[model samples]
Structures are given as structure tokens and as C-alpha cells.
Target: MTPEQVMNIAYQGMRVTLLLGGPLLITALATGLLVSLFQAATQINEMTLSFIPKILAVFAVLVLTGPWLLKLITNYTIELFSNIPAMIT
Candidate 1:
């Protein structure tokens, strides 16, 4: 493949990866921040306090977005595979 094609492929891969991972990561970050704020307000300094909520939030986000994420990745993979023969020639 040409340099431009290679770049396109890499960019698409990154996009897919980000799409798949961004939500749960963002949720975890938000959960951690909120937990920190709560702890500060209540004067309860518990280091492990954020873990369960973050895990639950990420799990919920994953479950909610799972189908959409799968669809996105499946479509990208299908498109890539469909073009492979053309790309080879």
C-alpha cells in the first residue's frame, strides 16, 4: 500500500480503538473525580472509595454501549476486509 493508504489504515485503527475504549475510560475518570469531591466534602479520605463506583460506572457504560461499539468495529472490519483484494492489486 501507498504511504497515504498506510496512514489511513493506521488512523482508522486508532479511531476504532478510541471509540471502543474512550467511553469507559472517560466514565472512570469522571467517577474518580466525583468520588474525590465527595470525599473532600465529607472529610472521608478513603483511598479505595473510588474503585467500586468507577468499576460499576465503566461496566454500566460498557453494557449500555456494547452493541454500538461492536457494530462500529464490525463495520470497520468488514469495510477493511472487503477492500483488501483491491488494495492488494
Candidate 2:
């Protein structure tokens, strides 16, 4: 494969990775921020206080988005695999 083709594939892989991970990361970030704000407002400074909510939020996000995320990744993988023979020659 040419350098350009390799780079293109790498770029696509990164894009796919980011797309797959973006929601969970964003959810965690938002949850953490909200938890922090709540802690500040209520003066409850327990270190573990943030863990459960963030976990639940991420879990909920995963539950909600899992199928769509799976379909997206599966389609990308199928497309990449389908092009393998062409890429080889």
C-alpha cells in the first residue's frame, strides 16, 4: 500500500475511534462537572461521591448508544475488510 493509502486508513481509524468514544467521554465529563458543582454547593466533600453517578451515567449512555455504536463500528470494519483485497494489490 502507498504511504497516502496508509495515512488515509490511519486517519479513518482515528476518526472511528473518536466517534465511538466521544459520547462516553462527554458524558463522564458532564457528570463529573455536575457532581463537583453539587459537592461544592452542598459542602459534601467525599472523594468517592462522584464515582457512582459517573458510572451510572456512563452506563446509561452505553446502554442507550450501544446498538448505534456497534452498528457504526461494524459497518466501518466491514468496509475496511471489504477493501483489503483491493488495498493489497
Candidate 3:
């Protein structure tokens, strides 16, 4: 495979990875921040509060977006696998 083809494959793989992971991570981060703020305001500094909220929010997001996420991943995988012969040449 040429350098250009290799870079293209790497770039596409990275894009797929980020797309798959970004939403869940972003939701978790937002949930954590909101929970932290709430805990601070209420003076309820429970050490585990933030973690639970983040986990729940991330799980909820995954459930809601699962089909779409799966479709995207499947498409990316098919595209990559289909290109194997072209890439090798």
C-alpha cells in the first residue's frame, strides 16, 4: 500500500473511533459536571454521587443511541473490510 492509502485508512479509522466514542463520553462529562454542581450547591458532597450520575447518563445515552451507533460502526467496518484488496494492492 502506498503511504497515501495508509494515511487515508488511518484517518478514517480515527474518525470512526471518535464518532463512536464521542457522544457517550460527552454525555458522561456533562452529567458529571451537572451532578458536581448540584452536589456543591446542596452541600451534599457524597463521593460516589458524581460517578453514579455519569454512569447512568452514559448508559441512557447508549441505550437511546444504540441503533444509530451500531449502524455507523457496521458501515465503517464494512467499508474498511471491503477496501482490503485495494489497500493491499
Candidate 4:
């Protein structure tokens, strides 16, 4: 394949990867920030306090977005597979 085609494929793969991972990562980050703020305000100072909430938030996002995420990855895989012959040429 041409360099342009290879780059395009790599770009698409990264885009899909980010799309797939962005939600969970963002959820965890937001959750952690909120938990930290709460801990600070309450003077809790418990390092492990944020873990559960972060996990729960990420899990909730994953659960809520699971179907859409699945469909997205499935579609991307299908499209990539379908384009394989063209890519080969």
C-alpha cells in the first residue's frame, strides 16, 4: 500500500481507539476530580476514597455506552475488512 493509504489507516485506527476509550477515561478523570474535591472539603484525606467512585463511574459509563461502543467497533471492523481488498491493491 501507498504511504498515504497506510497513514490513513493508522489515523482511522487511532480515531476509533480514542472514540472507544474516551468516554471511560473522561468519566474516570471527572469522577476522580470530584472525589478529590469532596475529600478536600471534608478533610477526609483518604487516598483510597476516590477509587470506588472512579471505578463505579467508569463502569456506569461503560454499561450505558456499551451497545453504542459495540456497534461502533463492529462497524469499524466491518468497514476495515470490506476495504481490505482495495487496500491490498
Global Cα RMSD, each model: 1.0, 0.7, 0.9, 0.8
Q: What is each predicted model's overall lDDT from 0 to 1?
A: 0.94, 0.97, 0.90, 0.94
Query: In model 4, what are the clashing residue pairs, if there are any?
Result: none
Tens digits of per-residue lDDT, candidate 2, 1-89, equal: 89999999999999999999999999999999999999999999999999999999999999999999999899999999999998999
On TM-score, who's better, 3 or 4? 4
Q: Rank the candidates by TM-score, best first.
A: 2, 4, 3, 1
Higher-TM-score candidate of 2 and 4: 2
- Please identify model 4 stretches exceeding 4 Å from their true place: none
The all-Cα superposition gives candidate 2 an RMSD in Å to the true structure of: 0.7
Tell me the tens digit of each residue's lDDT in model 4 across 1-89.
99998999899999999999999999999999999999989999988899999989999999999999999999999999999999888
- Lowest-scoring 10 consecutive residues by lDDT in candidate 3? 45-54
Error of 1 at 10 (Å): 0.7
Q: What tens-digit string does per-residue lDDT give for candidate 1 at 2-80?
A: 8888899999999999999899899999999999999999999889999999999999999999999999999999999
Error of 2 at 76 (Å): 1.0
How many angstroms is residue 35 displaced in model 3 relative to the true structure, after the best TM-score fit? 0.6
Residue pairs clashing, model 3: none
Best by lDDT: 2
- Report the backbone clash tally of model 4: 0
Off by over 4 Å in 3: none
